[model samples]
Target: GFGWPVIEAQASSCPVICSSNGPLPEVAGDGALMAPAEEEEELARLLIQAIHSFSTRSELIERGLANVKRFIPEKITDAYIQLYTKLGS
Candidate 1:
């Protein structure tokens, strides 16, 4: 399942470094730096990069804010309703 922490981090104005496995990459969009699942070295490198650079961090925060727009509660509910209606039709 897609987790809520990704959006929460963005909502709090924090950049995220998470795994690209499963829905994470799709969910994160361009908002996060994603490492392959179980790749500790890559994840560590991304963390260091995010931590040491101001511009990159800022860019991620900006993109994260933009990405989270798709997941607003009303928009999500409407999408589900549309899907269900289409299926019923």
Candidate 2:
């Protein structure tokens, strides 16, 4: 139900390696290298790949930081306001 790991990793300028199952893909977006959830070996491989691939990892960190901004309080409040306005109409 929660995917705080992605945000935490991104905030620290780390590229997240996450499972493809659940809301991980949506949460991690371009910030993560995703592998099938049940595949431990694939997940490990992706993690190693992330570590060895500096350019890709850097891009993921940048994208992750941007994605994390969307969840900030101000953005959340704005979204709430927009939703309320739509619902109130």
Candidate 3:
């Protein structure tokens, strides 16, 4: 029902540590640290790593923000216009 929070977190340059279920993986793309769904141990381990590993977390956050920005209205509109022009040709 909602995936915007994931995107927003990424946009704020925060790496997401999420349960590996639902549409979170899809929405997070390569910009998240996912743990096995319903597996507390795995989730805990990944979360710890995400929090403790500064470099990896920073990279994910940066990439995620960049990826999310690509879906912004202005950028999407520009892309649509380009596609339409190409199709019209």
Worst 10 residues of 2 by lDDT: 1-10
* Ranking, lDDT, top scorer first: 1, 2, 3
Tens digits of lDDT, candidate 1, 1-89: 88588988988889999998988888888999998978999999999999999999999999999999999999999999999999999
lDDT, residue 61, candidate 3: 81
In candidate 3, what are the lDDT values of residues 1-89, reduced to their tens digit?
55888989988888888877888888788888887788999888988888788898888888798779766899989999999999999
Candidate 2's TM-score:
0.90
lDDT of 2 at 49: 85
Residue ranges of candidate 3 with Cα displaced over 4 Å? 75-89
| Model 2, CA-based lDDT | 0.87
Per candidate, the number of residue pairs that clash is 0, 0, 0
Candidate 3: worst 10 consecutive residues by lDDT?
A: 62-71
Assess every candidate by TM-score: 0.90, 0.90, 0.76
lDDT string for model 2 (1-89, tens) is 76888888888888888889988888787778888889999999988888899888888889989889877899989999999999999
**Alpha-carbon local distance difference test for all models:** 0.93, 0.87, 0.84
